[model samples]
Structures are given as structure tokens and as C-alpha cells.
Target: MTDKAVSTIAELARDFGVTARTIRFYEAEGMISPERQGSQRLYHPRDRVRLKLILRGKRLGFSLAEIREIIDLYDSAPGERGQLDFFLDMIEKRRVDLEQKRRDIDLTLSELAEVERNCRNRLSELAKGREQA
Candidate 1:
């Protein structure tokens, strides 16, 4: 099978639904490296895949540093079992954190609903009192 040899900034941005500035920011952060052809930045297939990973990581709430670490691990020695183990540990931690956040949000929404109900009941009582007066 053949692969895409190169990609332009505009093409990738359009395909990924992100702005060119966002892709440039990732380049600045050392997430992806693209070759410069005069004033144009030409992204290789590797860069394109890296960008995909970076965007996916960002969407999953990973920090740039965390994403970089994971990407670096992917490029490290193939026999490094410890790196894979570390990545697994990181995934578990992230899962736990996200689950806790979900629980907190649910609790917050429940509290808000209760507060709204109380406020509505108070307003209804106030309206009844005014009518009786």
C-alpha cells in the first residue's frame, strides 16, 4: 500500500477541523516537526500521524507534557517493557481522575436541581401570600 508523502498546513487543518494556528502551536510545542520549504511548512507522514496523536491526546484531556512523554515512549527502544508499563499506569491514573470528575459533576448537578426546586417552592409560597394580602 502507498502512503501520503507530504501534507500542507492548510490541508491538515481543513481535514482535522482545527485552525492552522493550532497546528503551528503544536509545532512550537515540539509535538510535531515539519520541514520548511521556503515560506511553506511541509509536513511528512510521520508529522501528520504525530499531529493526529497530539490532537487526540488533547481531546482526551492530556496535557502537552503528558502527550510528549507518551509520544517519546512510542519512539523509544522497542524492547523497553518498562515504558509500556509506565504508559499503562498513566492510563489508569487518567481514568481514575476522569471518573472522579464525572462523579463530582453529577453531584454538582444534583445540588443545583435541589436548589432550583427550593427556590421555585419559595417563589410559589411568596406569590400565594401576596394573593392572600
Candidate 2:
């Protein structure tokens, strides 16, 4: 392997910013195919790149299955059109979901503000009652 490639599990994990267990999990999931050198896992440059993409996908809220599908598509066809289309679809769906979540959060915040106001008003009223008493 070249100098840029990872030759051991520790090197792969360090380069990818993941745990060794994560690499093993990805291997078990068939998301990556690393070579075995005397019971030690050796990752090449391609595996390193794939691991990066997988972690990025996870951070972007993509399921493992979805990440695998996207990665497979990219690996199978080294072009932009299909990937762009898929990304556009995913982005639109995520946008709509986020909009709905924003609306829900806004409503919850408004409700919380009302509750806080009411609690403060009640406390003030009770203080006034004690003063009068």
C-alpha cells in the first residue's frame, strides 16, 4: 500500500476519527472491505475515503442503509448526475422535515412563555396578598 493508505486498525481509526470497533462494525455491515493481515485489519485509501463518507452521512442524519446505498451508487458509477439527483431529493425531504420540527418547536416555546408569564403573575399576586394580610 502507498503511504497515504492505512495499514492497521489503529491507523484507520485515527485517520477516520472513529473507534476500532466502528471500523469492525462497518466491515460487518459490508460498508467497507478491509484486508486482513494476521488477524489485524488493514485499510486502504479507498476504505479510508468510504469510512469518511459513512461518518459524514451519519452526521447528516442519514441511516446506515441510506448511507450504504449512496456510497454504493457513487462507487458503482463515477458520475455526478445520479448522485446530484439523489442528494436533491434527500435535501428536499430533510428541509420539509426540519420545517415541521421548527413549527413544533415554535409552538412549544410560545406555550412555555405563556406558562412562565402566568407563573410570575401568580407569584406576584400571592406576594401582594401576603403584604395585605
Leading candidate by lDDT: 1
Model 2: how far is 38 from its true place, Å?
2.2
Model 1, span 7-124: residue lDDT tens:
8899888878889999999999888999999999998988888888788878888888988888777777763475577667878999999999999999999999999999999999
Model 1, runs deviating above 4 Å: 1-3, 78-84
**In model 2, what lDDT does residue 113 have?**
100
- Model 2 lDDT on a 0 to 1 scale: 0.83
Worst window of 10 by summed lDDT in candidate 1:
78-87
Q: All models: lDDT?
A: 0.86, 0.83
lDDT tens readout by residue for model 2, 6-109: 56888777766779999899999999998888888778887887888899888878889888877787755655667667867886887798899999999999
Task: Report the poorest 10 consecutive residues by lDDT, candidate 2.
Answer: 1-10
